[model samples]
Target chain A: MCFYIVINDILKGLKNQEHKYIAQAISIVENNSSLNKNLLLNLKTSSMESIKIGITGPPGAGKSSITNQLIKKYRFEDKSVCALLVDPSSPFTKGAVLGDRIRMRDFYNDSKVFIRSIASRGSKGGLAENIDYISDIVEFSGFDVIIYETVGVGQVELDVVDSVDTTIVVLVPESGDDIQVMKAGLIEIADIYVINKYDRKDSDKLFLTLTNMLQLADKDKWIPKIVKTVAINDIGIDSLKDELAIHRKHLIKSNKGLDKYNDRFIKKIKHRLISDFENSFWNKKRYEFLNSEIEKDINDRLDIDSIINKIKSI
Target chain B: MCFYIVINDILKGLKNQEHKYIAQAISIVENNSSLNKNLLLNLKTSSMESIKIGITGPPGAGKSSITNQLIKKYRFEDKSVCALLVDPSSPFTKGAVLGDRIRMRDFYNDSKVFIRSIASRGSKGGLAENIDYISDIVEFSGFDVIIYETVGVGQVELDVVDSVDTTIVVLVPESGDDIQVMKAGLIEIADIYVINKYDRKDSDKLFLTLTNMLQLADKDKWIPKIVKTVAINDIGIDSLKDELAIHRKHLIKSNKGLDKYNDRFIKKIKHRLISDFENSFWNKKRYEFLNSEIEKDINDRLDIDSIINKIKSI
Candidate 1:
């Protein structure tokens, strides 16, 4: 099959809201196949007014349960939703089990809730290189809400959250101490903070600490709200849903909605261009040259600056 | 002053073991000054054999306290030690408090122990772009032991740890659940795991879990040792130090010592080249061009791929 035909079929499938084609297209892009560039080039910006939300927190913070709750809430509204779990694969240990999917099995049989796990490929970037493209594909695939769930509170997950319109940082009472929270800088990035597993004895204290810290931090606008939830029991899910709605309305009314869309669009383009440059510039020949040079006497070779300049001139 | 003269003075002062010159050289590189390229090009790799240790874990894992103990241990041996704390600057708040330094006040007045904090600069990579060069500067400045302390167990910290000869992952009993440790992928990167604040009730349980996990993971030759410590009171510091020595000896006996050195050397070169490419490629003009293009209609202008190809071809 020619690349064009496959892409066209995928596009048709996407337009028709076919989940199979959506999955295939995502796979093609994630693998960085030859046709992936063409796929992105041919893709138009998603015209659908979809809400993109990023959920991030420390590992074992019930991020999966919170996401499951969000998925159920959206599905109950009769809205189609897609969730992308960005799993960070370890560079040394290749086996990274996406156990979060087991918790999300309820949505597996529901056609309205499409869930996909994307490995980070253990790249320097916490995200896969094709993440933006994949998100765009999902956005244009007729979903009303696209939720991105990242496992850890690393820079990679933070970058993913930054690219989304709304970001929710989930934390458990035992996740860390209040000082640890401040030191990790988690208090700054959250548009909304979720204190999951609120049944813990220390939950109220942590909540109060976070609220006080937020007050002291002096966030100019849109003070982040802390919501308590026992996600497994489906408690507090409605309040969380209402908070999301409130945030959405705030964004739209404050003219930040258009600004955020533009910011994400520009960021997507910059990331794509950088990725393309890296792919084209660092080919097999370049790697061989770099490896060989690295093995030689340092004084015998051209400095890194000169080599970069020469490459640019070429 | 001319760049050559300034660099020459700094080099002379560094050779004289002047602490002021070492700090100045680090600053010049950290800022990515125009003189940095020339400085790196002229500086040769360190000839003195030194131990590079990376200590990383989740925030508030008593990393600073552990580091302080290590520094004291090394200084007690009449060996000069330098510590680098890689702080992650928050993108939203832009306020990264160097609170770790306050804990190292005892070493501040001591000539044998030098402490420096490097900000992550909120770049995609966790380590700053010039971290390699800065480490090189510290290395040639005659420090016997160089310890890198990172605030979080993110990929940036992982990369930093990978470039070092020995990596110690510090954890507290309250850090997280066992699943969280596996999910964070911290199990694979530790040459030695330290359970700090060992007096906690679950510390013994966590230690057993880690040891079992290491066994199941099948580490080929060197088995990672789990040590317990109350770093604040200096309890178990000697045992931890002995484990570090044991790992160092194992690396030497297995002939991985040379391999690790070569790996770090190659990594340094690759990082420098990439940093150079990013600096030279993403100039003011390129930023303006990208920003302008991002504002245009998608179909009305060249796609990101074409733009990259055009830039490269130019």
Candidate 2:
């Protein structure tokens, strides 16, 4: 296919809310194909704004269930919702055991809800390079909300949280000891904390602990609210949705909404520039020369600092 | 103190296996102090070979218990063991919890064992940059085995595993569904797999599932062995040790032992060079100028690609 024709067809389908085009565009962006550059170039004219929510927490925290509940709630409100499930696991085995899809099977038939799973592909950046592009395309495709659901509370998930406007950190009663919660740095990134499986024993205690910890930490402009939910039973979904709406209001009222969006743009640009610099800085010839030099100098007793300095000088 | 004097003192203490000096040197390195360069320079001539093993898994997997058991087993053989527990968790709560220390309390008074907990400090690398330097210092200080324990199965942990001679992925029977293990990419990285909490009912099922998965995957040079352990009760520690030893023997027999160490050195050097380039590329003035430009251009409708291209041209 001609590059322009492919780009225009994808754009037209996206603008018309065609699910097939959205999926095709996401795949192209995820793989970072040549067509994606043209697609992104065309997407620059899109000014549509979408609410980006990041859902992250420790593993087995019922994130997928909560996301499913949120999707149903949003769809019932006559809003279009798109979900990008970011699995930081290996790309090789992702297809064989896609647990997230199984958890979110209810959305498979919903035309108003678009869902996609992204595997990390072993990038150091926890997120793929074109996540911003994908999100932009989805927003332009007329989704009211874009949800990024990541599986763990690692640095990669934290980076994903940074890219979103409002981050919802999901936790369960048996998540871990208090120390584990604090260690994961979950307290820092949470704009709203959801204590899922609220009927479980010790849920109340965990909730209190989190509330107390939030109090002890230096207060941010918007105090994080903890919502209790039994997502499997569809309990407290309304309150959770209301809390998300209130948080959005707070961001706008405090005039931080634009700042948050602008920050994401800046981050995207910086990442692109750095990636370009890295690609240009290390040509194939230079890389092979450096590799050979490193192998030859392995037994030379040269310290790493000196070796780096020598490479830089060269 | 003068830089040379401080470096000499630390180096002398490390050479003598003075626990205080080892701890102090690790602190200096973890903090990335100026004197660390001198210390690394002085230690490059020391050529002691210490077996480096990386142990990684999800939270609540009893990693420390298994590590404690390994310490006991190694100590029983009259070999000194040094463990660096890399907690990619927050540095803020690290001092407060020190949970791993509590879990491995048996090693506190054992002169043959030294344990240090490293908090990530939000560095881009899930590990502190000085982990290699600390490992080298400890190896030169006469430790027979060095163990790297990281909390989560994130990319940072994967990078750490790549630098080690052998990797053991620890898991529990209730570590979520079969999908969680596959999602963790744990299957691909394991030189040896330890199913801790073997007393659990579903452990046999998980074991069989893992065995079957391994059978389906492409064969590697060494078939990964699964060891069942009730780490708290000290079960299966000997077999795990034997498997690690056998893996080490395989590496030697395949003539990849030195190659592994050399690869680690090359990685360290490359990381240092990249970090240096980043630091030099983004000076304070340039950073401020770029930030201002981004903030200005964010609302100007200029796409990220053009901005990056312009920056590159400049």
Candidate 3:
């Protein structure tokens, strides 16, 4: 009874758009606390829809700067925004996290903008799995827009694409040769391509290369648009914004928007069911059984059959 | 009875070190065929232990060239080598696969050398899961050494490290600055650091950076060694090989070698069990139930508890 009462207060606070409650709700989800399921399930369904935007690119592609600019643009239109920046625990990429946080500090005092940095160290599913739940929390908080920013490493990009309606693939003049871009599968995933750091040398050359490549892409779907921007100087941001608007329109017209939402919905339910099943199935006795069997002799494959039999019996 | 006979023949051929049977056996595991388990379990344990070496680095770091050169050196000593090159399906990096294959064409005709490129496109566990099983197959075939070469993408490097006895992190002078290297978590994982393309200007700068970083690392553990090489010219590979030998000695003396093998053993058991459980638990009915529930209303969290209850009922 007491636990339910506490949850009710948190839900009440969330309904009031209190940042404190929002942060607390997100923390509960991040930690996977015992109360998380109750809190998540009891929260009121969002009547106000929120747009999810994903910003992804290779390291050093100015993704952070562009995200900052986008936040400002959205805020100017009086829309509240929540940004989730995924920081990989890798030491090589850790420095960039600090750099990104520093660049986006302008919104620190803005009550309407919420910024959170998620550590991708412990999560085996590469942070994307949790992003879905986190996005739900923020969306229910009445934020008009939610942005997911991640560095392109491993399966992170593909995972991000699966969860977001709009994906912006940020690149720079020196990102790579034309062939590298095509090979990265960046061309297919991007709803909009932002060639950031347009002030840099050879920016036009890359712009033209991307234009030519995109021309060969499938005409049946919404063709991705390329925009050049000097993120630091804030040039060409309006054009990028315009492209996003146009892409959003395409998403609705083509019913790809509904499709993406449906995909995410199905994926979430599947993941949740699997997780629930895993928890129930892998009991302490089973784990001990597994460990003892492995301790006997790792190289011996004789026990594998017995193990499979046990699994089958379930 | 016929399947048993076929398995017996393959096992006998494997004992004779026939490449055809080895290829067939590997294909069975790769495809996850039903006969894979029976064949894998029946194969004789390795009497001739094989050394496993992992060569990894940034995409343009001459990893393939170094792998090719290492193969040549091992072949000259009359030791058989099996190299598993993991080719990421990302288009940006796909071109390099062709380039690497062309560079390594010398070993195609060598009877003692077996080179197989594993496509990482479909594997959800990022190829590392299968690498363990495949390595066992090759080791059972009496190979002298097994080399795992992967580009540093996603968690592939970390996964490769988990499976290999020796890890060599290859980096070119142009890879990144010291901070970037540190952030990538490369400094901690490398048993040996190779500054490939050392003939390039500023190669010495990277070498010095790596040395300073190593000095700052834990003194109790084996301090990582840095080697400079112009892989294209086949310079400094002997030195790299010598470092590998020294590292192998360290691995054994420190008992870390046994620890790595044990860790792999435990992980293989765990992964296999989980996968088996997943297969049994996610039956057609459960999947159909999940899909139907999701299609009704994605936003409603009301059905989540019912789903959890169903999962728990198992």
Candidate 4:
């Protein structure tokens, strides 16, 4: 089949919520380093009211368990769910380390629920960009909710803010001190804070501290909701779902979703432009010039400004 | 003073090994997101034989203590040393947690040893690129040795491989399982592996395991050197320094240094090109276009391919 026919069938399958086409579409995006603009345009025109949620936390904070519980709550309401486990580890390693697979095993055979793991593959920014695109692909396939579960306490956590309508930062009683929390910049990114393993020692103290911290910040905007849970026991799962619903409602009422969509578009456009430049600009002659320039004695090497200007003229 | 005269003075001060000029030059690079080609060009003509060594590992690996000991050894020999503590954490946080400052207090009054800490500031690739430029400034300032101390076990560690001639991966007895060592891709990046806290349980075991793992890999290249040290007692530091000198000689004999230099040049050029593109391409008009495109109804939005093409045409 020709490329156009394949893409058309995929689009039709997406509208019908076919499993094969959804997987195929995700594969196309995952395999290509550059954004698949053709497929993206086709997917953009078919919209769904899918809610994108991001759940991120440091390792061993029980993010996967919380995600599994959330999935159960959504499925019970007859809502289709898609979970993207964004693994920031080396791409060569398997995703089993996160325990996301075992916690999410119940939905393995469910046609309405899909779970996929994504690796960074040495591209830090590209991973988040791909997540933005893949979320759309999943939403186009008729899923009602998309959850991005990323493990870590770094830039990856912050990047999720750009793509998702609601961001939930999971923490444990043992997460760290107030300084570490503030240093991670988690306060700014979280729409909801889940203090998982809430029955553990100092859980209440952490909850109160976070509450006070949030109160001290700008109160005009949406103050983040704090929910406590022992995710393994499925405790507070319903309340978590209720908070998500309320947050989704607030997003619509405040029109905050439009701002998020705008940010994603700007970032995607910039990423595309850079990718295109990298793809098109380098040639054999330019490389040879760089090599010879470096080969010059340290005292004789040309200025970088002159070299950059020359390359532009070339 | 005008820009040219001030820069010329700074260059002269750097040649005289003045600390003020070194600090000012680093600030210039850190404060500017783009490469300052003029300053870099001025730096190119000056030459000094400085050895750059990178020390990286996971947190709590006693890296700072080890670094302190190395500084002591270099100072004992009357060699001027510059240490760049590349903190991968949030820029808002101080670098006190790393303990590099506490351990190196002995050298704070010693003009022969210069220490500085760098933060990521939300730019992942840009941090490594700046490190490359900073190393040159430090080298051009008559420092005999430049050591890059980064705390992490991820992309930052790998990126250091491009800028430095030697890389030392530090590990504690309780670092993790064999799987984690492989998963972190540590086996591939280590030119030297230091099993610190050697008195702890399983230090010998980790040493043997790492040695066997290295043996199974490609033997045509220089086999990674492994060492054990009780950094607190200053045990085995001389041996570590010996290993560094041997590696330096091997790099010279094997011409591996040239390959590293070549890789650095390519990456710097690419980073420069992307930085230029981002600075040049974005404007009020392009941002307005992006805003309008995203503001459209989901089903009526312009295709990303067409939008990118349109922006390019404009």
Report every candidate's CA lDDT.
0.73, 0.73, 0.72, 0.73
Which tens-of-lDDT digit does each residue in A1-314 have in candidate 2? Answer: 68778888988999888899999888776666744654463465222267778998766677778888899888888889999887665644664236677777788888888888876542334253566667678877978988998766555675677667889998888764676666566777889999999999999888888888877666666789999999989998789999999988888788687777666676676666556566566667656656766566446655666655556665
DockQ, candidate 2, comes to: 0.36
What is the fnat score of candidate 1? 0.30
Ranking by lDDT: 2, 1, 4, 3
What 10-residue stretch in candidate 2 chain A is worst by lDDT?
A39-48
- Judged by whole-model lDDT over C-alpha atoms, candidate 3 comes out at 0.72
Best by the DockQ measure? 1
- Model 4 chain B: worst 10 consecutive residues (lDDT sum): B40-49
lDDT of 2 by residue, B177-294 (tens): 6776676667778889999999988898889878877786666567789999998898898899999899888887886777777666766665565566565666566566557665
Tens digit of per-residue lDDT, candidate 3, span A34-56:
45644584344432267778898
DockQ pick, better of 1 and 3: 1
Question: Which portion of correct inter-chain contacts appears in model 3?
Answer: 0.21
Model 1 CAPRI quality: acceptable
True contacts kept of each: 0.30, 0.23, 0.21, 0.21
Cα lDDT of model 1 by residue, B68-111, tens digit: 99999999899998888776556422333445666788887887
TM-score of 2: 0.89
